[model samples]
Target: MSTDFTQEQESFATAVAAFCAREAGTREQRDALAEHGQHTHNQGLYDKMAELGWLGATIPEEYGGADGSVVDMCILLEQAAKGMAPIGGIGPTLITGAAYEKFGTASQKGAVLGGIVAGKSYSISMSEPEAGSDVGNLSCKAEKTEGGWLINGQKTWCSNAHFADRILLVARTGRSVAGGVTRQERGEGKHEGLTMFDVPADIDGLNIVGIGTMGGKEVNDLYFSDCLLPEDSVVGVEGQGWAQLMTGLNIERLILAAMMLGTAQRAFDDTLEFITQRKQFGRPVGTFQALRHRVADLATEIECGRLLVYHVARLVDENPTKLFPREASMAKLKLTETAKKVALEGMQMMGGYGYATEFDMEKHVRTTLVSSIYGGTNEIQRDIIGKTYGL
Candidate 1:
């Protein structure tokens, strides 16, 4: 992977950094933008970004977007995250956008992608209480009806749903393959009968409940009780949601990896600043061989992660229609786990001050800890990568 950023890329990063710093540079500014201390999805700021054409980073030109490449999207996200901007909704939104661009009908694209470029957010309800890692095993059934599909099931960890205009929903549409085999009879019939639907967030019989965590009110649990939709709500073909989902993982994982890379850099930079200033026995603590070597090791790891990220990003960019499951998973795993290490190590190095809410290190810890878990756990990513090699 090329380590150089073009002049245009450099300028774009600078612009993003300036925007984040100007908009949410201070603790008070960030707190005010982040509702209830949540560091994700500040709609007010997101609208401002939309106005600036940044929210359309992933959408195509037909939807009033910039038609930017994956690398371009990564640049924007990385810079925003490095600046600690609270635009968490962008990640999930882009992941959802990728699906629509790939599998959505013209109307579906017009509604979702166009809305996204216009500052409207979206979410995906893939995981259930029972289908976190085993997404293929989801049981959220959507039965056929005269009007449309009648969805009835529960979905959990629907990220940013409360702030979204629509949710890219995946549900079961069949119980057997043309009366050939029942799901149980086939064993691990995780992929059959699955379908994707573009559901309005405020649709009747669909409920969105917040799930609170250290990250605040970001994710949600959605309950669908007889949620009726139009026949046109079906995205792409029925019973093909699994394949559509697989196609989008490259984007989803890369989006997350880019953000985490920025976070790791920020944590490392903050720690370096602190150790260089804080005195230990009449000298800067960072001057110590032990601390210096530790810092060096982390910086090296982050550098390696960055290379792997852009490498996979370029691969995806070169062939947007193709999949690089092994490389993308490796990028996701490397950046997320390395970010966790960087954040935790920074906190440990900062001692009491790091734990204090006054500093951003603690927040970095809170954010990075979850990166490895979401976007599929690091263990799952490892499995994906290993399976490619006949493991």
Candidate 2:
């Protein structure tokens, strides 16, 4: 991972890690920052990151961002996760922020991108009850009407929507459009007729209900009932949402991969620290051949994951417009799976202590277990990779 980073990136990583350690180094601090287990995002800590200008690591300088590359973002994300920062909002925020950055009108960019740098979070809603991996099957509809559009549909698994300033809502508009300034963007298929909307989080007729899960209130079900949106709510070319969304996948996958890579490293680090201290059979348990072999194997897997994550990230920075269906999917698949393995193995090694909330290993286990489940599940990632090879 360090091989792909420049000196400035390294310094940036150090600063972010140091800041995270200072702000959220202990469980007590984390509990306070996360609002006593109500949610994982710590707004105070997030605001501090914004003040330090880290949240805009990949945004353009004209918009109050550093204009950093994808690799730079990976560095920021990995260090934050490795330091165990509790800001859950940044992942989704950055994803949606990129959409606006690439396609939003001047006003939209000024509102959303500028808000992002000012510590405001954002979200995107692409999944419905029946359309998780099959995003093209989404039934969420935004129909044209007088003076604007009326959206009426339900979107589930809309992460961070409960606290977002705005949401990038993708809904089905129609198929085989006749004419518009961007009409040619309407490709024929299930992927066609989709449109992107900038839905304000507090807009009337939109309801955000939290869904309790193993990860707490990180996601919500969004109900849009005749949600009236201005004609300008449309983002990018009308009916080109799937193509627009696909443009960001390389960075999206890289971002998730880097974060999970950090989690894997942290899990391994925590396990090693525990085993080195907790003596069994008159010596540190980590000294035993059985545990030592397992640690070695997990360590190797994490390193491999880290390398792949950064390698793919560099590819994105080099080819900003190209689709990396195979490589990006591979990175997401490798790091998420490896991160899960590391946490589970760490749990097994620490025995009862790993299962106890008093230890961070249990938290690692919870987070890593779901890394493979979100951001395009590992199963879907495998399918994408296989399809890339014409399978």
Candidate 3:
């Protein structure tokens, strides 16, 4: 099958590329801004993007969004990654907003979707110290109360929590696993016990503690102690958070893949520029046969990564209900691995300059490493793919 972007999509991609070149590209500027622990996109850039309707690319126009396709969003994300833009804060927001659009109540959509479209940040809080990959084993408890629910637990590795206005939180409310529930009773038994809640950042008992990450992005450890949310806070239905989370994870993986591909492309571009200028043995290093072959291999792998990410995006847009566990896993696995390889190769090609803080390759390496670990590790992704074949 051939992969070609529509004219409109191509135009949008061009616009994003120009925006990144002007606003976010360059290691010194990005590093300086990220040091503040706030979003790297300043108010000026944020407002510009919001005005251009880029912030709400995946949101429906009815809710003040751009009413764009997921492919369009991927395009923007890829460009941002190529520019080395710090879009981590916005990435989860798009995925969570779509989740709310897909499964949240009317009020939930009205409250959450509008804020996100307005350029306010949001994050998803699912990982805990005890439960990173094994989300089913999460111990965060949400006991039903007279008004709403009392949440008491800790969540770690919550990205953008420091600046997020809200979080899409998952907590346990029932006691059943994969195959125990009957067909009629399955919705309740399989998903009935878990619940999703929209929790505001400033809620009285919610505490956010910042954690330093390798890539200079700030993640947080969240503590919820008797934090109370109204009954209306429940996203789709009580005890269905697991199912809802599963429903949106495919999109999440695709988004992560897009971001990795973008970063990898940037690394490749930087490496090309470096080798074209940097001389070794009295000639440009890029002219050497060994390095030229390596560049060719990296280019081919990146094409594979792009195809995998775009294929998953198309599949999701085409069939929102069909499970794409294997495809999503493959995309995440391939893109992150490719990102890591590209960064490493870029570093090797650049030699000492690549390791120096003056060059972006060092930061790119750190960032790519974190991407592999986030959204589930590459090992876990491989395991999921393996399990799909009934291994």
Q: What residue pairs clash in candidate 2, if any at all?
A: none
Cα lDDT tens digits, model 3, 203-285, are: 99899998876655468899999999887888887887888888887889988999888999999999999999999799999
lDDT tens digits by residue: candidate 2, 323-384? 89999999999999999999999999999999998888988888988898888999999999
lDDT of 2 at 163: 89
lDDT (C-alpha) at residue 202 in model 1: 98
Model 2 spans with C-alpha error above 4 angstroms: 176-188
The full ranking of all candidates by TM-score, starting with the best, is 1, 2, 3
- Per-residue C-alpha lDDT of model 1 across residues 188-227, encoded as one tens digit per residue: 5768779999999999999899998999988999999999
TM-score of the candidate numbered 2? 0.95
Q: TM-score, each model?
A: 0.97, 0.95, 0.93
**Total backbone clashes of model 3?**
4
Deviation in angstroms for 165 in model 1? 0.5
Best by TM-score, which number? Answer: 1
Q: What are the RMSDs of all candidates, in order?
A: 1.6, 3.3, 3.6
- What value does the lDDT take at residue 88 in candidate 1? 82
Record all residue pairs in model 3 with backbone atoms less than 3 Å apart, i.e. clashing.
174-193, 191-239, 192-239, 194-239
Candidate 2, residue 292: lDDT: 98
